[model samples]
Target chain A: MMTIKEIRKRLDGGDISCRELTEAFLDAAKRDNPALNAYIRITEEEALRAADAADARRAKGEALSPLDGVPFILKDNINTKGITTTCASKMLANYVPIFDAFIWEKLRDSGAIMLGKGNMDEFAMGSTGETSYFGATSNPHNLDHVAGGSSSGPAAAVAGGLAVFGIGSDTGGSVRIPASFCGLVGLKPTYGAISRRGVIAYGSSLDQIGPIAVCAEDAALVFDAMCEKDPGDMTSVGSEPVTPKLTGSVAGKKIGMAREFFEVMSPPVREAIERAVKLFEKMGATIVPLEFPMLRYTLSTYYIIACAEAASNLGRFDGLRYGYRAESAADLDDFICRTRTEGFGKEVRRRILLGTYVLSAGYYDAYYNKAQLLRRAIKNEFSEMFKKCDLLLGPTVATTALQKGSGLTPVEMYQTDICTSSVNLAGLPAMSVPCGFDEKGLPIGLQLVGPHFGESEILSAALAFERETAGEFLKSSGMGVKL
Target chain B: MISLDELKKLANLAKLSLEGEDVDALAADITSILEFANTVSEAVVDLPKDEAAGAYNLREDVVAPSYPAEEILLNAAEKLDTYFVARKIGGTGA
Candidate 1:
């Protein structure tokens, strides 16, 4: 959880060379990857070369930025020029992006060593990383457990110490779930805060690229670099600069614990939230009770709308354009059918079918259109609640990391996102900070949700909570992460 | 409320071939998902009145040159010059 400032100090004092730092990460990745399975691709040769260039630039008295020389990883869904940008799907297994994602271009100018791609759910479809084509990323804390995903590999990479910090996409708790289970800091900034261009689309309205790191402040650093209005993305919002300041105290701030959100969680998750409330109270923050009955439909509305949009967005992957094309086909129809049939995985195909079903000619009004109305209701409920409190508190997930292939039905798996999905449906900013470990030594995460575009408040609260409850603890079982 | 037959139909529509194992798995997942679907239906019992759904003010539409056709087609397992070659259908090409 070394801050960017501390790492920069080490680099400036010659205590560590960029090459050594990059190599240290690469060497560690070689060791941990077998256990964690965090990376889809580890570009050691390119990363080392980039690190060498960074060192040369520094030696010439030209520093790229404060983030210069830092080594990091990106979720596979974010396009990287010349590197395969497969969204953990066979459909684009060999598809290489010709242009860099906007965030990639931004970070490149900062001279951060690109440690390569992390695995994710195919097309950012699933909450658990289990749906990936490559394989499920193991939780760094427990190899037998899942690294919560679709941002699975990025979360595992950062938490497992494969890299300092990694970028991930969150379209309904993808980033937060993994961050929670892996014991790292994960943030999903407001919907339009970051540009979505060049990043593979999931749910156009909900999909956003965020950061996962060992600590919230470092996430803030990466967050600052990611936020900007890009003309490429129609949804990008250019407004008030996101200047995250951790200097303020949480004393006298009002934190709301919604009764409705807490009703559906398990005992262990409840205990974690209780602990967070007590800690915030000790920090002199007022704990308030807030009610939002409309939140009950968050998951339902999310699935309907997300599927509808995904069905539309993913249609562009037809064999005629870019993506995997079927080797043998009888006609255009046969070709598209066979290619998509062969290319997409079960879970992805499931979503696409559900989406198409909901958006189809006859059913649109009954499903897709209804979901939109529910979405607006969910949004209104939060807006009213935010009027009474500065932040909303809850557990990131209902339970700790489940054992990989634990035989839970998909519905049971979907329920794990009960607490986190609502925030996404509301288009609010939220952070998952490691609270403590459960009885079995699994990490539990406390979620802090802020009003729209309230990333500064979210980060400040997370930083304060981490500073007080437990100094940053990396879930890396042994060698790397220490409290 | 969904049935195994419904799941099969959906999978076929999605162009996915499913085995008995997949159907068994998806049946349970889809059922539980519908429970949540019921919740959303109740919340929006009445859709919002006609007001333009907030549309994002898109930047001016400009068709810029993208990936070259050659590079884009390079990864295709089966392709002809400037076009992807597919299996002939209806015995027309034959």
Candidate 2:
């Protein structure tokens, strides 16, 4: 699979037409999607049409953005005008958006071709892709193992060379986890850095649409394009362009190694993270050992807040507006109840119930309010730590991709997001870059977390690591379009 | 552990029916999740002053051209004359 730069060079040199490139990706998706299940819907017609437009623009010598003519995958949750945005759930399985999402509009303007909607966990609720109503996305590295969720399909599609890069949303570890599992680069930008308008909300405060790519520079390119303020989403503050500042320099940088994150990692993950730290040290980065006791409370806080928001956000899915409607209901109330009960998957129902439990009158103070307070404490800890270090270095996840049908309980599954959730809670920028592989040969991701709106710093560090490793740990699955 | 009755009530509050499903297993799952969430109660820290209170990015109050009713209602399961169609209040089977 070629990087965006290489693809751009070829397109510029007239080595390949945009239509041909798009066809290559579409053909790859056709060939590999049966085994990978990465895409919920392939927009073949739209892709070719867009490719022709790109070719016409190039022919007319119109200015082209870096992503112009780039074929990519959009996560199913992000709305595309007249295209189905299912959130990988039965509830919205047939629901097509009348308007485009904010990020999609940006990408569309940049002449990015949409290959399809990537599969994800149903309503972006689960850590593993298994909860998706479409089907679990298989790990490209090893087909038996699961692709991490809820951005499983996007990561898998990118790793399998189905698309140049994929746009995915990260609530907890959705983007980064799968990228880590698939040996790709995933970035969850600082909260509110990108507009969430038309993004089906899960954990509204925690969710940020990010890029899943093969390298840090590619992630930076996509992030730069999408990070912008929008009137539709008031929380969106936009961001500085990190792509220009990716100097790939770690000299004199202070990288904090939080002991708490290290203590929870599996042996292989720990060794990989330790090796990454050593490499950064060799690159002239100062390692700052730190104690972040607040790490233990993050998972509970994240789930409580995320689920509470999810419950509220999903209330709009009543039978009247759109999506699945239950048949043979006695009344309005019954209609809604039956529709939701039948439409939502088991995991989504569980989260909704949990959220309702926490926000209920009597339990509000005990659960929701307590979680909010803990959220503040966690955010404050991250804020303080940022003062001591340029970035926080740790494992993206505690373990590698688990085999399909691992059948871990719900709570156990939620525990896997421990390493990635805190970044969302604190509304910080973070990226998961492939560092090494486990004994099973699954990829291990080293996380670089930065202060609020500190995308440039973290991305710079990630690029430096990517440059040093020179794609050593970033092995290909040898499945998709190889340009 | 959450009782079956409590689980049913919570499910009702969430607008979901617990019919024909494994209520016992769901109850166990929710109970364990609640137990996991209970760990937050042990966190000892002064509640940091809420810095984000009233930090909303309020756009100028202007009437913008909204999506046409036909377009907005394009995805509606049932619609009539630009309005979403729903079951009448307190009405029985259609």
DockQ score of each predicted structure, in the order shown: 0.43, 0.75
**What TM-score do all the candidates reach, one by one?**
0.93, 0.98
- Residue A270 shift from truth in candidate 1, angstroms: 1.7
Compared with the true structure, what per-residue lDDT tens digits does model 1 show for residues A336-448?
67778788887777678778778767677778877887777778888898999999898899888889998766656777777888788878899898887877778888899
Clashing residue pairs for model 2:
none
* lDDT tens digits, residue span B1-94, model 1: 5787877677666655454346665776666665656565555355454434455866666888777888777666567788875556555331
lDDT of 2 at A191: 89
Residue A356 of model 1: what lDDT? Answer: 76
What is the lDDT for B24 in model 2?
Answer: 81
Error of 1 at A144 (Å): 0.6
Q: Chain A alone, TM-score for each of the models? A: 0.97, 0.99
